[model samples]
Every structure is written in structure tokens, then in C-alpha cells.
Target: MPHVPERRPESLGQAAYRQLQEAIETGALKPGDRVSVNALADQLAISRTPVREAIAWLETDGLIVHQPYLGRVIAELDHQMVNELYALRFVLEPAAVGMAAKNATDAEIDVLREMIAFERSVLDDPIERERHNRRFHNALYRTAHNRYVISTLSALQTPMILLGPATASDPKRLLDAYAEHTELVERIAAHDAEGARAVMMRHLTGGQRARVSYLLNQQRS
Candidate 1:
């Protein structure tokens, strides 16, 4: 019989959490998928104890919910949740973009530009493109110079990842996003705070529409 591979000693709880988190983020586990502690422990080559511990944490995070008899399942992504997410984004991100335009240092602006370039380079790889996109936005949030906003936005990362790969999966959409990002960056570089805010609002609105469309299509399929 095959034995569990021992790569190195690590915190089993943390390791299992990371494993499950990645699966959920990448849609490998997917929305509403039933989670089996025994099967997951086997898959991760770990014990059920750590898996249960991780599951308990995930429950607290609202990423997984316990049903009466079904145990824990990945939380469902619905239209209402999408609306609430975008509503929060609309309120937070435009302010972030405006602040970034007015307050970002030269080095911070340069980092943002480099991130856009990296995003463009990964057009063929949706996962990497999305990763760079998140990096760019995180940098923008930091450049906003609001520690509170940064912390709040950081907490949203997991759900943002759970939104799936639909938006970045299309080549044309990527090109369009690049253009929008270019405009946003140019405005920020010029310290046109209002212009940057406008562009960001448009970007967020477009993203929301795309997400709704993707979710509707998935429902039909």
C-alpha cells in the first residue's frame, strides 16, 4: 500500500487550511460542493484532525456552512451576494483610485505601471492575469494611503477569488480591461483624481455586469 508522502514538517492545521482555500479560490472545490473530511485528508495526505480544524475555521469565515444533515458545503454564490459585493466595491474602490491619483509616490506609481505590464504579458493565462490584476489593485489600495481601506479590502480577497475565472477568461475582455487599466493609470499618473475615480467606477460597473452574465450563463448550463 502507498504511504503518505512526507515532504517536511509544517503546521497541519495551517497547511490543510491553505490547501482547501486554494481549491475554493480556483473553483476546484466550487460553490455548493460537499466537503468530505476523510476524502480531503486522504487527498492532502494528512489526518482528519487537521482537516476538521480547518473546516471549523472556514465555517467561521462564512466560506463554508453546516447544514442539518449534509455537513459542510462551500457557500453558494448567488445574485444577491454579487450585488452586495459590487455595491461595496463601488463605494470603496472609486475612493481608493481617487486617493491613489492624488497621493501616490513616484515609486508607487511605477509599481502600478509594472503590474499592468505584467498583466498584459499574461493575457493567455487567465489565472496569472487575475493574480497580477489583484496585485495591481492591492498596490493601488496601498497608494491610497488608508490603512483602514487596505485592511478592509484585504479581507475581501477570498470572496473576490471565489467569483471564478469568467471575467479574465476571454481574450477580448482582457484587451478591453487592458485599455481601461491604461486609461485609469494615465489619469492616476497625471494626478487627475476625478478622472481616475470616473474610470474606476466604470471599471467596477462593467465588472459587475460581466459577473452577473457569467453567473446567469452558468445557471443555464
Candidate 2:
């Protein structure tokens, strides 16, 4: 699914990892898709060693798993994993937004506003919406100026790809989430730390509930 050109003689291992990881994150490689090390190496025009190295790292990161029959397939989000992800966000993101309220410059706040506008422009495109959703959150957290929180949230990106985004499912859900993002930007711009934190909590809680409902319906189907 990933189309990479010939190796550039740089860090081949890191390049392989990035290409493979990007494919997983972008849905070019979806959940439960069987991964072949040889296929990946050939596809990227790299050798087997780097691709295997990348696969090992992906397994360690929980983006890949070895099942009884499926071999190493892309991991899916189960109930427990969903709960754990939201629990971590509940602890980290709310506070991150609060810190962002206090620390973000007007320029950084403006960047967030621009991302929200861009998100609206691409609401009709699922792929672009998912991409901007990650961009928006990544920008928001960086405004907080806390390296530890940023690092923790960054580590969650791969598994979060499995869960996808709030906007991917329903048009109504996308509008609701857009409004929430607008309000969050306003709160941060006004330097309302507690208000921003409260808004983030609501956003995360809504996303958590939606994801759980989605998983249940998926099972029934």
C-alpha cells in the first residue's frame, strides 16, 4: 500500500519505519490487514533487514500483533484498549489544554484557529478530515510548552490511528466536533485555563462514548 522510491542511502531503517508507519496511520493499511515483511521490503525498494526492523518496532508499539491464524496483522481497537486510551487522555489532555491557555502566544492561538478553518473546508473528505484532526490536536498540545505531556501524547498516535477520529463516522458528529474545537480555541485565546480544561474534558468524553458505541455496532454487524 505504501509506494516509496529507491533508497536514498540515508538511514534506511528509519525511512522504512516512517513509510510503514505512515501507511498504517493513513488507512492505506487498515486494521486486521495481514503484513508481509517481504512485500513491504520489496514495495519500498529496500532490503529485508530494515523492513524487519520496522516490523519489530511496530509490534512493540502495539500497531501490529501476532494472532493464532492471522499472523502479524494490523491491530484493532478492542474495548479495553479504547478505555485505556481515553483514560490516559482524560488525565493528560485536559491539563495540556489548560497549560496551553496559560502559555500559548497569540500567534500560536491563531495557528489553531487556522487549523479549525481548514478542518471545516475538508469536512467532506474523510481522509483530509482525519489528517487535519491529528494536526489540530498536535498543534494544540505543542502550545502547552510541556515536553513530558507532548511526548506522552505523541506516543499514543499509532494506537489512536486504529480508533480513527470523531469526524470519520457521521456528518452530525463532525459538525458537533467542529463546534467543540471552535469553542476550545476561543477559551484558549481568552486565557481561560479552567474553561479550556473543562471544554477538553467534554470533547474527550464525547469521543470516548462515540467510539464505544461504534465498536458495539461493529460487533453486532
lDDT of 1 by residue, 137-196 (tens): 788899999998898876665577776665576666678788889889889999999999
Candidate 1 lDDT score at position 168:
73
Tell me model 2's lDDT, rounded to 2 decimals.
Answer: 0.86
lDDT of 2 by residue, 144-218 (tens): 999998888878755877755432777777787889999999999999999999999988888777778888887
lDDT per model vs. reference: 0.84, 0.86
lDDT of 2 at 6: 82
Poorest 10 consecutive residues of model 1 by lDDT? Answer: 164-173
